[model samples]
Target: MSHVGKSKILFVDDEEVICSMAAEFLEMQGFIVDTYEDSREAFDAFCRDPDDFDIVITDQVMPKMTGIELLKNIIGIRSAIPRILCTGFSEELNHKDEKEVGIDAFFMKPYRFDDLIGQIKKLV
Candidate 1:
């Protein structure tokens, strides 16, 4: 179902399995997904070609850097790209914090793929 003009996504998570799985799922839905298991590395990739991606979906509580920190850095360079924070640790971030962090959307862990798709479509 891949399309030439599908929205490109950068999905970051310290957990390799989670990132890979989500990437596969999103890809099947026709999105171009690039998965990163390290937030720091993801930042570097984003910096190298910020315009290559349309949106970013990342997990919180990473090793070298947190997702919020990554989003902040990305915004500093390119503020218009949509960002989504997806984490199992809901207590670590709330609606107010998400807004303060400049994320366009927030999704809790175990979110439905369809719901995520809807948000992605809405954002991009």
Candidate 2:
């Protein structure tokens, strides 16, 4: 599935491979994707221009800050922006109430790009 407009996305993952692959896939689907391996840098970029992104997809595990921390910062800046938390660890989801934390969607790692696209479509 492909999106029509170029909806800008902030995608954060500690893994370089994941960031590169996701960026390529999302760009192919007609979305403008900005990827970051460092959560702090991603948060800084978001702060620089909060309105620049329509969606934020981040991995739970990261170096400086966890995805939850990054999402919380983003939410404080732009509460309405759609946020998706992706993680390989089930324990991460178990520890927090996603709705309460302002997450729009939760995706497991090793997910299909089509599924991710579907979520983006629904949220956007």
Candidate 3:
């Protein structure tokens, strides 16, 4: 299966290395991924064309905006866009309940690339 409709994935994280790693792995899986070190910049890219992405994966602990904050912003614009929230703050996040937060999926940090690929595939 060619990841046609499932290609465009956005990865947002404060850490440059994590962003690069995710981008590299996801891209290798035939996904069109763009990574950003800041939510503001990522938001700007998304604002240019929100519909370009099929799925979004963001880290939880960022400088200005956390993953939950990012998710809220994205949902405001594109409600139905599937999202995967990856975080180390899972233990402290009140929105861990997917039903309450309306998240499509959640992946804890240090997650395996293959697992992420599979989950994203299922979501899309």
Candidate 4:
């Protein structure tokens, strides 16, 4: 789905393929996406300029920091910016936990691109 405005998104995933593909897909759908393969780096970038991004989409599992951790840090810095957490099936996260963390949305791996885009449009 094409978004109304050029929403800038920060997408973080340890897997380069997923990160690259998602970034390209979002860009194609009329969003400006910045992708990172390292969660810490992504967090650093976010802290550097939180206002540069309209939304954040991050994968749950990573080497340096988990997606939730990154989101937590982001929350401390800029809670108002919408955050979306995406993960493969994990016992660690339930809907309750996500809600407690205050993320705007949660998506599982292999998510439908259209569905994710739709959620993003609503949030942004």
Best by TM-score: 2
Using lDDT as the measure, what is the rank order of every candidate, best first? 2, 4, 1, 3
Candidate 2 lDDT over 1-124, as tens digits, reads 1245579999999999999999999989889999999999999999999988899999988888988888888888888898999999978664555665687888887899999999998888
Local accuracy by lDDT, each model? 0.86, 0.88, 0.82, 0.87
Clashing pairs in 4: none
Better candidate number, 1 or 2, judged by lDDT:
2
Best prediction by lDDT: 2
Judged by whole-model lDDT over C-alpha atoms, candidate 1 comes out at 0.86
lDDT of 4 by residue, 2-54 (tens): 24669999999999999888987898988998999999999999988888989
As a whole number from 0 to 100, the lDDT of residue 90 in candidate 4 is 70
Error of model 4, residue 97, in angstroms:
4.6
lDDT of 2 at 93: 66
- Per-residue lDDT, model 1, residue 74, is 91
Residue-level error in angstroms, candidate 2, position 105 = 1.0
Query: What is the lDDT, from 0 to 100, of the residue 67 in candidate 3?
Result: 77
Error of 2 at 83 (Å): 0.5
For model 3, residues 1-124, the per-residue Cα lDDT tens digits are 2256447988898999888888888878778888999998898898899988888888878888777878888888988888888887667577444554487888888889899999998987
RMSD to truth, every model: 2.7, 2.6, 2.4, 2.6
Tell me how many clashing residue pairs each candidate has. Answer: 0, 0, 0, 0
Angstrom error of the Cα, residue 1, model 3: value is: 15
